[model samples]
Target: MTAPTREPANPRFHKEIVSFTRRGGRLTERQQDAWDDLASTYVLDIPRHTSSTSVDPEFQLDLTETFGREASTIMEIGSGRGEALVHAAHENPDINFLGLEVYIPGVAQALVTMRHLGVTNIRFAIVDAAAALATMLPAASLDELRIWFPDPWHKKRHHKRRLITDDFVPLAARVVKPNGVWRLATDWQEYADQMHEVLLSATGFEYSGVWDERFDDRPITRFEGKGIAAGREIRDLSARRINP
Candidate 1:
């Protein structure tokens, strides 16, 4: 395969390849109620430069103000329905959690979970996470980053669209503080292997070159349960950011 191209400076209007695709759907009754009751508190209103998922280049989140206190922040990429995110936030009240997603229905579903769980340490953003990492977040500002079960983009020709690529690793490295840990998991063997390869050689990062055990804090969401029932082995890996 040819070398992967650098993402344009403005990822909002990026060319063909992207880590995620936006999804839309009507919210359910519970979801609507959650949105009505909790969205103002839990969902961040990010200014868009081009589209709904776009984060304005100058728009950096004031997370301390957003969360109402200074705390260690953890960001979960593609936090579908926030099942595991809210669970983790509930378990760790001292830490702040951010769930990044582009799907409106899923964001509302996450709000539904937030209402049921009554967790305040967690918040949700509808911006393109990869773009947020590229320009919106402060350098070395995050304590941890999690990406669980990102779409595998199964076909060989479409692997370029996978989120854990060589080009994407640097953005992750840029945002995570020195010694900050990046935890990722996937059930797709090929995608897991590719993530392993890309992360092992990633600059400003250090890895054991071995798969880590499953993170105990990560709850088994319905999505993960389905992967298990389908007889797929879940691979978990963690890497530490190395300061320059």
Candidate 2:
């Protein structure tokens, strides 16, 4: 396999977070324990960014534990900065939200927002959404999955890294129950077309009606703000998992 080419775009448009495994990574035992304790104690289910095996087994929830709950569960993959998660959690207190974003700084910022707002219904993990569906979630467990404004990777060589590809959609279908919603938003036109094609081609899923600002009044994300500043058009695609 060839190496994925790195594109230097507007720094603000992309995440500034570094991975936890990077060299010179330092976290005090208390901080680590806090992360673990919060993960374990939070009754509302949240995904974990790290491998659960290294942690105490009591904190972990298996398929039965995850699926046994009757609450409407929503997992927003690529939940950068978690603004949507916090907003959704605040607006709809009845639904349980699980957000997964791979950036530590973003997670910290989101946590601060959650604390300031006193939003208790949402939980977070820092993990790649593409990889998490197969491993972390059980079949037909989720009610809705959101992937909004993911990295377009506009360069031709980096297209494979786009989250809406063939490989990831089926895994999404597997995790979401029948008729569950998969909401995707993108500012890049080509990437939006790619998302449409790939999602429509994927079995067990069907593309629903297209939406605009009038239809869904979602807050403008940081990345989308940049796109708007550059006079880019934002497109949203809503698809449903028809077959479990």
How large is the C-alpha RMSD of every model relative to the true structure? 6.3, 8.2
Clashing pairs in 1: none
State TM-scores per candidate. Answer: 0.92, 0.74
Clashes by residue pair, model 2: none
Tell me the lDDT of model 1 at 97.
94
Model 1 Cα lDDT, one tens digit per residue, 1-244: 1111223465546654677765455778887787888777778877877666778998888878888999999999999988889899999989999999877778788877777777788888877787899888889889999999999999988888888999988899989999999999999999999999998799999999998888899889877898999999999999999877
Best by lDDT: 1
- Prediction-by-prediction clash tally: 0, 0
lDDT of 2 by residue, 1-244 (tens): 1111222343542342321221112334543444444444332343333332112223333533443445788888767777877788888777788887655445545665676677767766544454457666667878988888888888897776666787777788888899898888888999988888887687888775345342253678798888899999888887788864
